[model samples]
Target: MGGPPGPFSVPLRLSPKVLLIDPVRMLPSLLVPLVGVLVVGGFSPRSYLWAAFGLVGTVVFALIRWATFTYEIAGDRVEIKRSLISRSIRTIPLERVRGVDVSTPPMHRLLGLAVLKIDTGASGGDGEATLDGVTVGEAERLKPLLLRRARTEATPTARPEEERHAEGVPSERVIFAVPRRWLLYGPLSGAYLLTPFALAGGAVGLAFQWGDDLGFGRNAAWSVGEWLWQRPSLLVAAMVLLIVAMPIAGGVMYAVFNWDFRLKRRDGYLVAERGLINRRSVSLESRRVRGYEIVDGLAERWAGVVRAWAIVTGLGDSETRGQLLPVVPRADATAVTGDAIGPYQAELRPHPPIARNRRLFRAVFPWLVPAALAGLLLLLTGLTVWWVLLVVSLVMAALGVPLGLDRYRSLGHGYDGDRVAVRSGSLRRSTAVVERRAVVGWRLHQTWFQRRAGVLTLTVGAGAGKGGYSAIDVSEAQGRDFPAEVTPEWLAPFLNPPPGPHTPSDPPSTG
Candidate 1:
């Protein structure tokens, strides 16, 4: 056999430079020195020596193996070749490549290296095959090349704007970045990182104080309060420090991660790019998106911010999926939404007073159970002298009315040609939009209690993961008409059958 066919049928070469990162493989090497230090501090010297020898051997072997691995972009394909004992090769066509993501962990940042991930949309999925170490400059240079390749392989079509008005589909647009301030003030502000820090610090301080009280350490005389007092100025300084440092740090991180975020009009596609030290970009074709939703909380409303997200297929395996724009001004929500979903407007529908009557008796009313339980415990334990359960039940019932009213006010659905719109919320008001062709199914339901009250509920289902259902409770009369009035023109064929030729149109020419 002639040299077993050299890797590829054509001659190929890679750049001489190779970036090396031994993330988990470097763990044993790091542990050896710590073990040696402990051994010097009066432990087993022989054990330390053996461990060191093993670690060194492993590190040397890893380095050699890693050095033998190489990759190259040749013609319209990517070639990866690596071997220590048994050789292996992988070739990916250019068309299969989705995008490349480059990340720099803190350690990699210090070393001026980045993790270059080639997302090939392989059967293995996104972030599938990654080369974990490359210089920042090299990663950047490689990005355009990979994106260009993906673009070249992609089919040419109409501009995003033109595609928005395409028949049987609601138009959608992509937004890359909103103001950094909005992100910080909105969803990002609620990030749970601070809660853990607060809890951990409190626990540690409490443990230290308890240890001191037990005379465990003579030097540990400080309580958390005393410690704070000792550094009174420092505590104040720390508060001031966070106040100033947080926004700057957050803004910088947001800017970098979300840097070069561009929302563009591509035919039937929405593309989003965000990452700070590590960059990520996503492209969602129209068919992959299930629906659109608007999220508005009290904070969002007070800040004039509104967030929008979509139910997407194959995108949100991570926590960051489901959102196209994590936060934006409420005013901008409409415009940006219109851009993404062409020519659809929100309309409010009035609900009859009877429609809301059942809300007071259903799940919303059951919150009284918790309040009543707490109050009964207080009374029985002699914690209070009053008939607290009665008082608590009254208070809960009072709150339920407003809750019911808000739900009633917030519920509505409308259709513009083949597009469907439904709005609902009590605190975080929201509107969901979907095209008729996009609806997978629908259902009408009535609980036994609802039937007794002469009311029914309807839920509209779509294909996306999160915002798939739009539900509302209405009077029985309204329920009967709801499907016909809201069904989009494109979906009418599916919802109802054509009238048969023999079906009577009039009352038998009625007289």
Candidate 2:
């Protein structure tokens, strides 16, 4: 990726071990014939011969695939060519390279092999070009070189590991990693809700199948029903224990999925690596990072922590889900998030407020209407605990009065140099900070009510993370001038940044 030392080309192939380590890709063909032999114990000897033939053919196909797959580095581009049934060749220019991710599954680590992935900022494209079974050192060396070459910069001479820190190269200085205690977040992350149901589906199916095998089909059902009535208290206790166990099960699964999660800021890229069984590593260009989304769900907000994810283009859907800062304290989330995307300050400074009437109307119309209707129904029907229900409903509605006021208080958007930041939300709050240069366009929305109230929803669309973030319910006057203020070209009529020369950004830290 260092411009290839002139116009020469070098072709590379996967390490030999991939034919063994990656046999999972070949499993479907193998499994079909194996299953046939299991079903055909009554059939002739030809069944055995066919199974043998199938195993041999699967191996032959795998070896052929390994032999034909090759990637080459040339003067200006990287080329990958593969042949299985037909031939496919892809050429990616060095300048267009957006990310280089290196991942090592457990087997790959045992054999010291890794897969290096390259992503270009194009939609509907295959996520990356993968070179499987490469050595760890090669992946480490190539990730940064790919980004540097894409920037058309000269490759710096390699230095010792300890001395390289000051070179502004993306070296291994850990930014944020999952702490052992962070496992607390694991239980709250749908462990109780989804995990138990998933567990029940598989468990109930297996239980019925075993009951049928044991000739206890109807008897098993009757026994459980009989026990529920006979030992009601014991059954209730068991149910309580099961309910308590679900989140723990979910938390364990979550820990396994995100075990050993580590994040790093490289010279010109941000890298993340996580997973226990099926491990993955992702490296994204810092230059392509448009912004950061500091997200807090109700539980996360209660814990006073937030998660951060990169808002970048051409990275896979998974990375956009905030692998950058999976779960960190609010302070760390802010500092690391700003570093991930260049020149951001995740502050809570005030911007223009939405009209007070909007909040007032929202509080009354949405909350009071439903509460009043439900309360009236309870009264008219004379339902049990009708008075209690009425009280609870009114309390909930009254709570919204303050919530509406807080929602208005949280509404703000401002600029710091070329970056525009917006903070909005009441329950699950988010502060989205994006660079002005990254803004591709603006989307303005006004409902009949919003129009009458002099506020509008201004969505800033960028090439990165989920494509857009809204500056919800800003004053119409501010919404009209917002784009021009952030990036003049985004507005049709523009007073472009008072014609002045711009200085270059300093080299970012290797945090």
Candidate 3:
């Protein structure tokens, strides 16, 4: 496939399997026409002809796209050429290649096909270009050559023999994979809890939108509401059915999304690839990964499970930013973090360097806004049922207080010669770790309350992962002394000069 890789040029068409993948991806676009045909079929037989025409149009389009798309690696750039109406050539320099993400969906895997997405930190478009369907073998060969500089040892004394493959055995290690038992957590992770409410609300909204067309007059809405109000048993059954259906749907989604999920440590980057139907692979260069965000929600924490995400720039969009590791035991997550970044203590030790009670109050106080609003509503309209809602809101605020307190308790900052760490959140706890070397700048911020309380947030700025991590509500002295302690010489000019003039030997002068 493409002349044995290694910077050779050859025109390659997308795998024929794309004919299968494209139609499914285009389902949403095809639905409007499909619905139109169904509506017209009620009046005439011409609808069948229209449906056949649409089907032919979609398949021909996907075919034309597959035929036109071709790419080659020649010189220092990987070039992609494609066209349906207008032809265009997009060239990405090898050195500018930040990452090459390759994914294999279930269908793709069966076909031995994969998608190659090239992200060059392009300002627009999630990625520069994607070769939607390509041979897995070709992708493997090209991956090493494209990322050769990145994967190789930086030392000048590095040997030719060290090239993981200039000979072809990629040093890919499995970082993690989803365990079968964790499937239960999948429903909990997704929309299962809220699915019933969302589905019910959506049904009501849609019914209102198309009621007249469906021969349900405007008065039909109020009539249905009255019927539901009169029949508590029927409403409960419907709710129970929705609730029961939600978990099943959530479980299905979970299985589909996390099927064969794997995180692989490969030449110079970490690749997270998963999915059953529409698989995705995201590659994060080690250098661009300034830090890692460890996520553990209340339930996951209770279950002793934790997940981590790569905190990298440019992949800020939630969909593209790949999770660094899968849902594994909390202990395992820690061990992996230590292995990948370095030994992080707040993770190992946990629950230290807590924010003061005032900070805890500040955190918990904001959650009461919903309860307050509910009370106001109850006062204006003395509905008996609203009392139940107000009670629930207050109960939630009560539950949230401890969670908020726990979040404040989770606030911690530490450094151990190589890395600086910050931990925050309780309901959804996160610990960010950045190498001391990756830090580009330091900033200390103090609000009026913080000033009065003698505390400030110490912000550590780096090139990766949203650019900054703050040590929330840290003591003033800690904030002032942190930069000097961590990156000593770099921030000395902006901060106090390392106490040179004020050294103990020269401290005799009161002036």
Candidate 4:
């Protein structure tokens, strides 16, 4: 019989095309040095020669890297070995694998290549590794091989589904797909709305830096300002156009990033596929999914749109990885959450009315301080601008009442069957649900004001997404009993025994 196998028995190499891809990936690192050379050496032949040398060096380094890197599925573990001088080997047990992400950037897609990322679901992201350049077929092949053992082990009872999925057949079914109209929620998400502005600011900053380097920054800035001052109507038109473009730009980016978004489910995994320029597909093991979180940004709530994500264990850091449903109508989000996790329709229990008072007081107090400060400043300096500031601060304080009411309305917690749900927040309202079994601990927090108000905050701790979800400002009674009701095994024993019959004990008489 042949000897068992060598250390690199079935070693696999990345696509040779990595020679081109790797160098391009390293080009960003060469920028600063190249720019420095150009700045110091000017556009002379010497600078060009130095730039060429750098490019050659980058290409050579890429070649060495490509030659050294090799990965393989050896036994029950996936092994990756790389580095030219100091060889390093990384081994991941098949059983610990929780997810696999495959992404194809525009360049990779053009070259028919993909990048495979292994997610071992380590809380610290220590076991995660990315294979940057692989043929599309190889990525697909490796994905299944790496995750197959994990899926089988996770769901030993799911024999039929596992068998079908293992054969590379179409065993998966679509749970939800984002409609194009739903893209309207993109602007309401509030993230994309500022993205264009942020990019513009960054570009402007870079332009100013370059202008300064070339010695015309101040003059250019002054000229632009003077020109804008000269043509006030033109400036106004430009401002209007910019305001109009923000939402449009946000919508476009959202669509491009999430075009044709689809959530599908196989036997033991939830598969999410999306992206336009950079197509991405991630497979998350269903067994580790604890529950669901529904988020409503302030604008999204006003628009009646929301987003949902699976609360999964060991997901770690990347919010996109747990996305169960992107921005959509509240009804659609509810359905997706129900389908992703188990269905629950229990009405959330509201907190005491005192809690509402607390919310309102807390909300307005911030603006009150500023308004008071501005009023004091105005009185002391008699400045018109300070008066205007005082007026604005008062108006903001007035606005806080409605915000406080909304936040109060958002605060609720309830339990149905074995699941507990808590909703809170104003700026980014979120409703988080977790199975009773998933409750790792319960924490009670009461500030001096809250204690005087007979209310406390109860935080539910779990091992999954975000780790802790709080039911802010509940009655002291609810704080004591709610946790015990949800997680009797852990909290019930710790509960204070019901007060013994109103005992009237004699007080000490000694001085």
TM-score of each: 0.65, 0.75, 0.80, 0.89
The CA lDDT at 12 in model 4 is: 87
Q: After the best TM-score superposition of candidate 3, give how far the Cα of residue 152 lies from its true spot, in angstroms.
A: 5.1
Which scores better on TM-score, 2 or 3? 3
Candidate 4 stretches with Cα past 4 Å from truth are 1-8, 35-42, 123-127, 154-170, 212-238, 376-382, 491-511
Ten-residue stretch with the least lDDT total in model 1: 11-20
Better of 3 and 4 by TM-score: 4
Residue 454 lDDT in model 3?
77
lDDT of 1 by residue, 1-511 (tens): 1112232455332222332346354775466455545555465776667666766776677677666677766666667777878888887765455545556675677667777666543334446556666677776666544444323333334444534434324444445456555546533433332443455468767577546544454355455457888888988886676655555565555565555555644434566666656655555554445467787775556677776776554443423434567667766767766766554654655555666776556535686776677677776785554456657676877888877777777778777766677777767678787776667667788888777767667677775544365556666666666666665464577655566698654444545
Off by over 4 Å in 3: 1-7, 20-28, 34-47, 106-112, 123-125, 152-169, 188-192, 195-230, 244-249, 278-280, 313-321, 345-354, 363-401, 494-508
lDDT of 4 at 90: 91
lDDT order of candidates, top first: 4, 3, 2, 1
What is the per-residue lDDT of model 3 for residues 1-511, given as tens digits with 9 covering 90 to 100? 2323445646777778779878777877777667667675863668877877888888888888888888887766788897878999988777677777777767788788987777777644466778777889887777766676565434342223224533455567776776777777766554455666787899888777566544455578878999998999998998789778888877777777777777777655677777778777777766566567787777778888877877665553423555766667878777776655456653322332335566556655665776787788889998877777778767766876676667767788788777888877776777788877778898889898778777788888977766788778888778866678888887667655345654664445777
- The lDDT per prediction is 0.60, 0.70, 0.71, 0.83
Task: Return the candidate ranking by TM-score, descending.
Answer: 4, 3, 2, 1
| Number of backbone collisions per candidate | 6, 3, 1, 0
Clashing pairs in 1: 171-341, 172-340, 173-340, 256-276, 257-275, 257-276
C-alpha displacement of 147 in model 1, angstroms? 6.3
lDDT of model 2 at position 24: 63
Candidate 2 local lDDT, 185-290, one digit each (tens):
7765453346766776678676776565444576786577687779889878867877887877877777777888888765545678788875777776655677
- Model 1 RMSD in Å is 7.8
